[model samples]
Target: MSVSLPSALIGPLLVFVLLDGFIQGSVVSLLPVIRDTLHTGTGPAMWITATQFLSAAVSVPVFGRLGDLHGHRRILRVALGTVTVGCLLCALAPTLGVFLAGRVLLGPLSATLPLSVGLVRDRLDTAASRRGVSLLVAALILGATAGTATAGPLASVAGGGRTVLWCLAVLAAVGLVLALTPRISETVRLASGRMDWTGAVLLGLGLTLLLGSAAQGAAHGWHSPPVLAGLLLAPVALGLWVRSSLRSSEPLVDVRAMAGRAIAPAFACGFAAGVVVLGGQGVTVAFLDAVPEEAGYGFGLPQWQIGLWIAVPALISFLTAGASAAVGRRLGYRAMLTAGFLLMAAGFGVEIVGYAVMATWYAGHLLAGVGIGLAVSGLPTVITEGSPRDRAASATAVYYNLKTAGGSIAGAAAAALFSGLLTRSTHQPSLAAYLLLWGACGVLALVSAALIRLTPRT
Candidate 1:
């Protein structure tokens, strides 16, 4: 069956994704400024970022499943509304604790995209759905690019970061308005059974413990009492979650299906993409912002310059993501996926060897951007199409959560590397820290490529 893109539906969905992406990108660039404004140290400031991802790891699946049980459009509106409150809270937060709480509420921001995917699947034919999904992902990257590119300039124009935070709140409110409009169509409520709250609570608790332990381990030594307690208890919580899910009639996630051939490899790719891409983000920004004389290695760029450098890769990914579906069809999904990871590996390899040269470093980022764009766009499509139609949102959530989990692990690992390789005289992270991080990311990309090759073609 032939289908056309429905402007009424696509327009609002695009706005939601764009708003989410913009919030994500702008927050990263604004973190240092926010930390200073709140008079918090680096350790606590890091929690602001960590909280968003941690909460998202739990919220995505819960929201996705809710979208399946109810209607996607309805759930999409709820997610958008929830995030608006989060943005407002962050904008006006008087203390670090309040800001972190706001970030937790913002967790549902990640769910908007997956909910939109369900809508697309419900409303469009397979071909149209692929195009729709590609467009939404592209918008997300594009929005991130815009946010990164503009955040610094906007902050400067407004004279502080609070103004920028207000701007994000306003954008989220606008997205909510759009989602609530009558134009956006609701998806069919195909799934049955009530939400598995017990499973959700177990899963959320498990992830919170796991991520919290990693963060604390980085701050305190791994053997520290709190860290040790968290690390030991995390597994028990997760195992219980798994067992409970297996017994439930309608679990929050299909744990067994996630391990099946069709979905498992895609999940692996998602995790690797997180490790190779999101894992390196903070390091890249820090390297660009570092004063060479003080750090003994870096460009010593200002905030806006740093944002611009990061935005270029995001911009490239926007283009590549928009085109990924067409390219996947021509190259075959397996070939495209394998090639994408290889390109990311090549990109990181270039950075590892030629980091001293600005031109070469940029080229590396551009290549990685293309690879990430392709890989991320393809993985969701693979997962959704492979899943039972009624459970598509949950499957996508699993992929997303795995990706976030990988990033969390990588972030902790990078912190360890920096701590271990600090330059004594400068008291800053040494060049060895960067080299090791980049090299590890490159190797992970290469491994992902190999795993993709072994998976059956999509």
Candidate 2:
């Protein structure tokens, strides 16, 4: 059966995907600049990044479930609208508090990715669905890469942080319009499921506390009362939420889904990928900022140039991810994942080597980007294939939430490493941090490969 979509539909969908990714990438990539402008310390800067993830972690599950109950199209439009508002708040934010608020609002908007995926699945026939999914994933990679690459240039051209926010706002508006125009069918509708308000609250608070503690602990010292309290409270809250979920007839997250063999490994791989992608991104930006002009180590590129540099990998990743989707179709999902991990591992290895030879840094970034593109492209397929039909959206949400949380953890860890390693005599760390981080990426890829091998072929 042929599934035909209006020519207009494709452009809108693509725009929506691009804008969503662009916002996320831009925010993370521009953090260094934001920190400089705001005069915020490393701890606070980490919070800016961590808060976005924390918000998404809490909101994705809730919104995804709600999306299932209501309509995905409705939720997507609302989410995109929220993104516009958030971008505006960010642009106008006079203080750090206001900016954090904007980030908090942007959390629910992360639903853009899954909602976009669901739209394609619901609206398109099998063949079109495959193509749509491929394009969707490509847009995601592109947005992320573009956001990183363009942020510096955009900020520079726009005249400051405020200008970047305005640009995001305009893009978000375009996404909102696209989301509103087409009425995509909502395929998955649960017959009866009460919103687990208590579960939602508990989960949100628990994640915030836990993630906040992790991000802040290194900066403030883990022993600090605020950090300790957050850490201690998180597990307790999580335990309570789990108990609540198990008892509730309609749990917010179906814990059983998480326990499935196929699903569990998918989540693990997504989490690992998040750590590497975000950690590598954070390190790249920081490395650019810290490298000295006098030493051969630094490019001494302006913010705009640096942004472009950051973007190059993302662009490469976006293109390669599309290629990966084709490979997945030909090679099977499991093979696709394994191949992606291997590529990523190779990329990280290249980075490790390049860091030693400063001249080769650009090549290392390109390799890393290719690896990220490949690995990320396969994750959605893995999650979908692994999930039970009944709980697919929730399962997808869980995988995503874990990935975002893992990325936040990586950002924090990297920040701590960079700060601790700062020395008067030596401008850059002994390259040990970069080596360890890259090594960790390689290990994660290998582990993902093993897991992919262990899962029974579909």
Give per-candidate clash totals: 0, 1
lDDT of 2 by residue, 201-248 (tens): 999889889888887877788789999899899999999999998999
* Error at 291, model 2, angstroms: 4.6
Question: Per-residue lDDT of 1-458 in model 1, one digit per residue for the tens?
Answer: 33368888787888889888899989987887899889999988988988998899889999999999898989988999899999999999999999999999999999988898988878887777887888888998888778877887788789889999999999999888888788987776479888999999999988888888887788889989988888899899999999999999899998888888877888898998888777875588888888878988788998767877887888788888888778877787789888999999999888877888888987897899899999888888888887878887778888888888888888888988898998999889999999888888888889889888766775
Where's the lowest-lDDT run of ten residues in candidate 2? 182-191
Which parts of model 1 are misplaced by more than 4 Å?
A: 1-4, 291-296
User: lDDT of each structure?
Assistant: 0.86, 0.74
What is the alpha-carbon lDDT of model 1 when measured against the actual structure? Answer: 0.86
Among these predictions, the greatest lDDT belongs to 1
Model 2: per-residue Cα lDDT at residue 231: 85
